[model samples]
Target: MTAAQRGRRVLVLERANKVGKKILMSGGGRCNFTNHFVSAENFISANEHFCKAALSRYSQWDFIAMVERYGIPYEERKHSQLFCLSSAKDILNMLLDECSDAGVEIRSHCELTSVSALDHDNSRYQLKGHQNQTPLQLACQSLVVASGGLSIPTLGGSGIGYDIATQFGLAVTKKQAGLVPFMFSDASKALCERLSGLAVEVEVSCNNTLFRENLLFTHRGMSGPVMLQISNYWNPGDTLSINLLPDTDIIQWLQELKQQQPRSLLRSGINQKLSKSLTSELQALWWPEEADKPLAEFSDRRLSEIAQKLAAWQLKPSGTEGYRTAEVTRGGVDTAAISSKTMETKHQPGLYFIGEILDVTGWLGGFNFQWAWSSGYSAGLNV
Candidate 1:
């Protein structure tokens, strides 16, 4: 759109028959296009400050204004994450409409095979690939690879972008699954399986980072916002400390409840604070050999131990669901080789890498899409 607006011919090569498959699937179809609040703090990148310039140049307010210009109704969700009030189609359509106005030619089902410099001076780029099942090639003064990262392979997420960076003699970083669920360790697998489908508001922490959000139990492992957020900072063999009852002082609550309901069974009193199913599972896991007795009969030390366990329950995850379910990848082309201001490689002029192809990975919100817009626009202005 920027190239065409500048009176330059523009072409958009898409590998899919449709242009916005991922956009349509984002935010459960509502499409969290951008966030009301965004800053360098929201992203994770090898060069930590690389995203600042582009983001500042094309801020979230810029995109929101554009959405408003197109009359697309949107709503602000949790943490200022903005979603289309109607559907993701609205955002996609707005993009398409802008491209149309700019006379941008969109060729769908275009798969790139190779890219090489046309001249020794790197005057132009030669792009050879198949377009709609037909062989095609291009010679352009500039090339922008926004091929995204390895996340949802079903949606065409792969290492193609990293492959391109490697082909260009640039450094690519180690990549891993990000914003993914955690698989349970052997010791916790059975309990997680038994409590599958149960959800609790929890504060989960790992590596000095913490997130308070919903924690969901799955047959395979643990998931939900809190788990997903903490997974980004977790490594293999790391144990996550979780507070199931983050809202209350568990020790005091239990002591008071025991004083008032001395005749109540331990499970029953705990059940008052948690679900019956969860209480039963906890009893089996924490005190399996012990008999279910009145709260008055249990020793203070036993209650203290139970309280401490609930306050800082520690569990190590086995692994993750991998790219199949991850929202984005952890690493990509090293930012040290690229220019933060223009999204262009310093070693290779006229060649740009934007969006998820870069090492910048945002939090699980609309931050990723915002990076795309900001970085793409930065390259567009320069290209």
Candidate 2:
């Protein structure tokens, strides 16, 4: 929009039959467009400070203003994340309306099979591909590679972005699934299967990082906001420390429960705090020796041990579910190879990279979309 406002002709090429398929699916169709407090601290990148300039220049407030201008109703959710009150289609339509108003021509189903230098003497890019099975070729001076990253393949996520960066001699970093679920080994899978579909608010910690959100137990493994958030820092063989009871002081709470309900069975007493099924699972795992015993029968030392175990239960996941279920990818074109201020290639002129195509990956919620707006806005101002 900025480029068109500055009188530069703009054209957008979309490989999908429709633009913003992913956007339409974000936040359960009600798109989480931005967060109330978005900063460099909320993002992860190879060069940590690479996102400061663009994010500051085009903050969440700017995007909110656009949303308001379009009269798109929105609501604020947990963690200051904002979501559309109606549907994600509203945001997509607003963007399309803006592009149309600015005279930006959008050509959908224009997949570029190959992008290479037109000639050594000229600084133009020759794009070749078939649009609707018709021979398609184009030449342009300024090229913006916003092809996105590899995550959900059905959502048009692929490695084309990295391929383009490498083709242009730009450094592409190691990419991995971020905001994804974890899978357990065969031995541990049975536990998750038994607790499948059970969701509880808990703090899941790994690699000295902690996420206080809901952890959902799936038939295959674990998911939900907490697991997805911590997965960004998790690696193979890393053990996660989960605090099942974050709000209660387990030791003191256990003693009080035991004192108040001396004749009650440990399972029965615990069932009051947790679900009966979860309490059974915990008793089977933590206090198998005294699971059936009454609270009065348990010694102080034994109660302490159980409390300690519940407070910091450790588990090592076999691996993640991979990009098939990931929300966003971890890495992309190296930030060191791009100019932070303009999102332009330092070595290759007229070539800009933005959004998921870059190394910047935001946390769960609306951070990623905010990066898309910020980086895209930055590139627009310069390109």
Best by TM-score: 2
TM-score of each: 0.95, 0.97
Q: What's the CA error at residue 28 for candidate 2, in Å?
A: 0.5
lDDT of each: 0.88, 0.89
lDDT of 2: 0.89
Instruction: List the lowest-lDDT window of 10 residues for candidate 1.
Output: 115-124
In model 1, where do residues sit more than 4 Å from their true spots? 120-123, 185-187
Clashing pairs in 1: none
Tens digit per residue, CA lDDT, model 1, 186-282? 9688888999999988899999888899899999999988887887788878999999899989888888878999988878877777888888888
Candidate 2: clashing pairs of residues: none
Which digits, one per residue and each the tens of the lDDT, describe model 2 over residues 46-124? 8999999999999999999999998999999999999999999999999988888899988887778898876543447
